[model samples]
Target: MRRPSALRRLSLHRVMTHADYVSTHVVGRSLLVSIAAIAVIHAFGIVTMGVSSTSALASMLLAAGMLYAILAGLAVASMGDDLGQGYASLYLAHPLSRAEYFAAWMTAGPLVVLVAYLLSVAAPLIALNPSSMLDASVYLPVLCIAGQISFHTSVAVFSSILFKDKSKAILALLTVIIIAPTLVVFVGGLLASAIHTVDIMSLVAKIVGVFHPAVFYMPFTPRGGSASLSLAYGFGASLILYYLGYRFFKYRTDI
Candidate 1:
């Protein structure tokens, strides 16, 4: 009986994992296109401008402006199948814990994002500029940019679990990335001016900055003065959000 039960548990894990992997097919194709596009950009730059068109600033801006939308979609695609498509009932009908299901989604979604960055972004950059791989000046910023993208991806995943709808999840992510911070700063500024306390706005801005973790590494050329602090905040916030999302998924009755 014990052996049979253990085997059943193992089988469920594989099933969940495979489902999550299959859901990433769209994201995988997008990443493949990105890789090809980046390579072409490099080739064009070499022929026309004497160097690769891609730079740390361009990469950071891309991550902040456009690439994040793709990554966020990837994040949502992994879990939306179960939550949005009513497959959660089928999966949960088994003796599987919700924790295991959540873990499988998290694992597969972010792994694809990381691999995408390596192949689509980093590899092409390095292919054209081999020496930069060894130069800390070059590689460190790239790694930091990747970190920023990963942080956003995690936030996107959290939003998907929170909203439980693919379209809303992506919308919420864009709001956090593009709108919330600006609004917070504006409101914070007004409150500070009214109270004659600049710290009020500063305090509010720092708190809101957690949602847009990529800002910490902006202007990736000079590098931020608070690189270590940015890493700490981004990593800490991601862990907190992940824990909250997992707990919500595990205990929520509606799902």
Candidate 2:
């Protein structure tokens, strides 16, 4: 029995190796450090440029989302290349199950990126010393940005494996990148519109606001409840995508 247990442990070791491959290859450690440097520069740019805080925050929000989405796309592209270029042949020849490999790959990308992003943001907050922007009300939804990134990353992983080509994988990622947010905003708007009868400007704000998360620590925004709903959708959708990815990977045949 102990001998069988030892064999099982040896077989399970591939999962960690798969995770290591993702951490080093999918998103390099140096790249994460460079992002931190960029964050520091962004803070300096904000201080010297006399940019309005609201506009600055909004720009950061959108930019972060776009940047993460692109990185996630690249990650999928890299993994798809691995599959397409026959790396998967050597990889799958081991005692490891495809499900184990997929689980490791799927989990590693989001976690490593999330850790990097958090480290990148921390330096900026410290160096900037802009106490004004620290208001929870203004930047509250920023907390959920990691979840949003993971959601995009999960979609990329699934689509990439299913398509089995880096180019097609990226295309699939882009399709979801465009369609998912639109759907989220539309659904959030429908919910928001049911509660408030507002004009074009207000309604438009409400619709856009649906993509932000609410801070339980602060008083409500004009559309705070919807913002909370948006946060839930963002995270909830990530969970769903991750499950779909895992299942697909478990059943997927090697290329």
Candidate 3:
């Protein structure tokens, strides 16, 4: 006597609610601010430095990545506090699975970061010269930015879930802030040693070029070039961390 149609509709409705949780939390505000900041920087660079198309594009992408990483880090860190005691209790009580909640939280931060990337590059190009915007090179930078931000977001989410205590969470966030730059330096040194390049200055510059969020906004340097490998590494690391976080969240009680 009952129809399968109604059950399917209810299931779809539940899916929609879970997916929309991140958007409902206003994480997009961070992305909006990132866009505005990048636009201002682009405008200033053009006015002062006589920016070329390539330089402008690079700058925009760098600004977008840096801003999004910082903001997304902060947003994810405060997820628990923002939910409030009552809401947190209610969220735990809901029929939704822990994996679903974790996925939603993780997904929201990256989505905002992606939006920031688009706005950062698109707004500048639109304002300065729309005709020059369409190019294959542009996709490379965008992909790099997305991969970097995705990696950072995964770290932020994992840290958030791992540390429930406010003090501990803050410490974890600070560690993340510092470790990225340190890791880039170490990696650069290893690369330089392996290559045995005599040009110390060029080696130093190249070492600084690894696409970590900390030094992303630095001006033109050889180190900033050829980051596809670095980006891929970041993505791979993020996936590993995300999976580890999920397993821990499923069995652990302290979180």
- lDDT, candidate 1, equals 0.58
> Which of 2 and 3 is ahead in TM-score?
2
Kindly list the per-residue Cα lDDT of model 2 for residues 58-153, writing each as its tens digit.
456546655655665566556677777888777778776776667566546655555655554544555565474476534444555655666677
The alpha-carbon RMSD values of the candidates against the true structure, listed in the order shown, are 5.4, 6.1, 6.2
Per-candidate TM equals 0.67, 0.66, 0.65
**Model 3, stretches more than 4 Å misplaced?**
1-51, 80-89, 123-136, 165-171, 178-224, 253-255
Q: Which candidate is the best by TM-score?
A: 1
Q: List the residue pairs that clash in candidate 3.
A: 209-223
Error of 3 at 50 (Å): 9.4
Candidate 3, residues 81-163, lDDT tens digits: the string is 53423344466577766665666666566565566556655665567667655664555566666666666766776776676
Q: What is the overall TM-score of model 2 with all chains considered together?
A: 0.66
Q: How do the residues 156-191 of candidate 1 rate in per-residue lDDT, one tens digit apiece?
A: 778777777777777766776667877888888788
**Which parts of model 1 have CA positions greater than 4 angstroms off?**
1-21, 24-66, 74-81, 182-209, 220-224
Candidate 2: segments with Cα more than 4 A from true spot:
1-13, 23-52, 126-135, 178-225
Clash number by candidate, in order: 0, 0, 1
Query: What lDDT would each prediction earn against the true structure?
Result: 0.58, 0.58, 0.58
TM-score of 1: 0.67
